[model samples]
Target chain A: MKPYELTISQAHERLKQKELSAVELTRSVLDRIHAVENRVNAYITIDEKLALDQAEIADGLIARDNMTPLTGIPLAIKDLICTKGLRTTCASRILENFVPPYDATVIEKLKSAGTVIVGKVNMDEFAMGSSTENSGIKITHNPWDLTRSPGGSSGGSAAAVSADMCLGALGSDTGGSIRQPASHCGIVGLKPTYGRVSRYGLVAFASSLDQIGPLTRDVRDCAVMMNVISGHDAKDSTSVPKSVPNYLDFLNGDLKNTVVGIPREYQSARGLDSDVADAVTNAIQTIESMGARCVEVSLPHTEYAVAAYYVIAPSEASSNLARYDGVKYGFRDRDKSDLLDMYRSSRSKGFGPEVQRRILLGTFSLSSGYYDAYYRKASQVRTRIMEDFKQAFEKCDVLLSPVAPTPAFPIGENADDPLTIYLSDIFTISANLAGIPGLSVPCGFSSGGLPIGLQIMGPHFSEGQLLKTAWHFEQAIGIQDRKPEIGS
Target chain B: MKITPEEVIHVANLARLDLDEAVVEKVSHQMGAILEYIDKLNEVDTSHVQPTTHAIFLTNAFRDDLVHEHLERNQALCNAPQRDETCFLVPRIIG
Candidate 1:
């Protein structure tokens, strides 16, 4: 197999055995990126020279027998994460010329581990849309089919990983951004439990709901990535103060005692695609045959997840994004006559239509006399959603559901319909609402050849179990073996 | 809970966005549809339930209020669209 096609584990084995150099592997991936980037448009930035330099340093480390699993690996970063000296655009024009002076906690960790920072991938503008169509820069196509969307706000990350442009990618999930795209692209994407990974450098979308995780070629790479990225940080007050577990060890555990919960509501959720339902039901049976019992669990508040998420996410987004008013950094409308006019003109011109819509919705929700009717009510419903998860977890070790109602649709399918787009996250948003880990693994392909994702969710801080279960299911089904026909 | 076009315009102004007046009706319709759906949450009796602002409990970390080395002024100003040698330049607020 070509070096670009190697998994993190495979590449590590070859590098340690002197069969493949980090530079060689890096070149192959870069070459693959060059070949497919026109069709995929996976990256917002690709510093080939910088990546080669990092690979050289990794080579020195490997030659000295000072190596970590990711020491010489090349990985893509979602543009939302701050990378010192790199333009972190968050796929928005407001920060088109902006570059960070410091690295995000995740970037610092990746750099310390000697991973080649391949490039920055695109995302939704301020993470407001379910599809990367809301991206202020460009739309990323699904590698499976150029006509279809790869999913969003981390659409570029998912597309990059699926197309082998990058072995792995870091994507932040606010309301199913990572997992939904991963499902659409037929790869493994995990949104670690809230506070499991530090949010210090992640451009905040919904501060309370956002969590950074990995989108990788397979489950093993997912676990390896979780080991490096998951940990508490003193920089972020919301970061949990807990010891990081060796996630790689969880892969060896058997699934004999695992109890998977199938929410009754999910099976009958409105707008669920027939093919996706079949794939998820089959996945449940596959897991059952592998000794993990599937239980019929009820999360009565499941139907309200989309509604609660739209309100709560926009409310947080309005507050978190208020800082980008052309003052300290980012785009500025210089022609405005006064400070207030400047703020209005810069934001109105810099932000895309979808972002403006969200800010309006958020401002409306939090406006006078409307707080109790909107934001507060949403939060109260969110509490009930968390309670639902707590109750469901008591009956099963993990909850199994479809990541999205369907696989990837056409690029402009839901572009004009914001309400329809919001409902696409119904299945995956609950995990974020409850601050629990949610993973999407490729389950099957639609008749149209698009990939379907099966979501596996666990209670807070239960990533270890989620990974092990996903690994077992991956081993049995061999779904990751089905590669997208685009990038390669 | 219908969202009027006037309310939409007011909300847009509050958000510092100058949406085209032509698009206000469409934006208002979309926003109203979303709000009416979220109104479903009102059907659930949440009066007794406490609001969850953050999924996980977090506490403020107190630090010794000593000044620490901060971002270099030049680097901090590097991305500013309008900046002088030291600080960002903005339109005059007090004229």
Candidate 2:
């Protein structure tokens, strides 16, 4: 099998028998990336020499029997992450030349685990859109259907994994950035409990909502990657100090005692594609067959989530993204007079249209006069939505729903309509708002042959349980073995 | 609920951003539509709910103040578009 196509477990087994060296594995994946990356546009930067050099070091550690689970793995990182020497653009022209002086905590952990990073993947500028078409540099196409998007702000990472350019990739989820793309690209994407993973090196989108996660081909790989990337980091003040779990240990048992809730609010809604509805229904039936009981539940405040999210996210983004002034870091225009001109001209030349729109909305909402009406009211609504989730979880172990209202739409379908674009993130944004964990796994395909994803959401710090449920579901459905024709 | 092009341009200035007139008119109309949609929030009663600042229950996540390291000034300035003897160069103000 091609190195890029090997599951994390299979690759580990081959490494143990000395059947493959980290250098060889890394090279093979890089070779595949070279073959197809232009067509997929998965990477913003491919560090061929740097990856091989790191792989050689991993090979030496393995020779001494000092191997970590990720010792020889080659992974792609979303451009939103700060890599010390590489330009982390966040797919915006403003930060096009910005390079961090330090590695993010997650990057530090990945290096410690001996994982070799192949390159940085593309994304929507500042994680503001559903389709990667919002990316200032280029659009990352879906591997399954080239005319469709791979999903955004983690679109390039998802495309990289689906197109077999990398074994796995790291992504950041503000709303549905990870899950939406994973659904679109037909892969497993895990959004660990918000504080479960450190946010130190991630470029700020909405500080309260941004979280780094993994995008892989299967649940097991997502679990392994999570173990390595999660835990407390002093650099990220929001990180939790709780002991991390060996996620692989929890992938046991059918749901005999597990009570999975089917939120009637989700199924009763309009706008859901018929194909996605069917896939989610069939997935629940499969879980029922495995002894897990399904019960109807209500999240009465579901309607308020998206509304609260738009207000809160933009408000936070307005504050968090304030650091990008010309005087501090990132792109600055040369032709400008005085401080005001410098700030305006630099920002005008630097930010893309979508980013500018959000910044304006956020600033207006948070402004002195409007704060009471917009931002304040939204905060109150957020509390209600969180309470709704808390109440539902009391009756169930986890909640199951469709990841998105539909499968990936055609690439340029909603680009012109900003409101239509925001609606794409409706289903997944609530989790971020509630600071819970959610994972999207490919259950089946739409009638048009696009991938359909089933969403599994859990309470705070319930990532282990969520992954286990998703793992068992993946096993029962046996969908991981289904690869795209573009798959290696 | 309806925002005018003038309001969009005003907000853009307050945010220290520059938007072309065409973009301002376009975004103002779109934002007007969205805010009009969200006006439905006025009907829901949220008087009893305490505003949620964060979803997780944990609090007081602080780090020690001791400085561990510092970046070399030259390396920090490497990505600067224009630089001078001691700091970044910008258009002269007092002229």
> What DockQ does each prediction reach against the true complex?
0.85, 0.69
What lDDT score goes with residue A146 in model 2?
A: 85
lDDT (10s digit) by residue, model 2, range A1-488:
78778977788878878899999999999989888877789899888999999999999999998998888899999999999997799999999878888898999999999989999999999888888888998999888888889888899999999888889999999999999999988999989887889998899989888999999989999989999998988777788889998998888866789899999889976688999999999999998888888999898878777777888888898888887778757888767767788888888888888888888889989998999788889888888888889999999999999998988889888877888778667779889989999999999999888898999998998988888889898988785445777643
lDDT of each: 0.90, 0.87
Tell me the spans in candidate 1 whose CA falls farther than 4 Å from its real position. Answer: none
List, residue by residue over A174-267, the lDDT tens digit for candidate 1: 9899999999999999999999999989999899999999999899999999999989898898999899899988998678999999999999
- Model 1 captures what fraction of native contacts? 0.89
Q: Considering chain A alone, report the TM-score of candidate 1 relative to the true chain A.
A: 0.99
Clashing pairs in 2: A255-A292
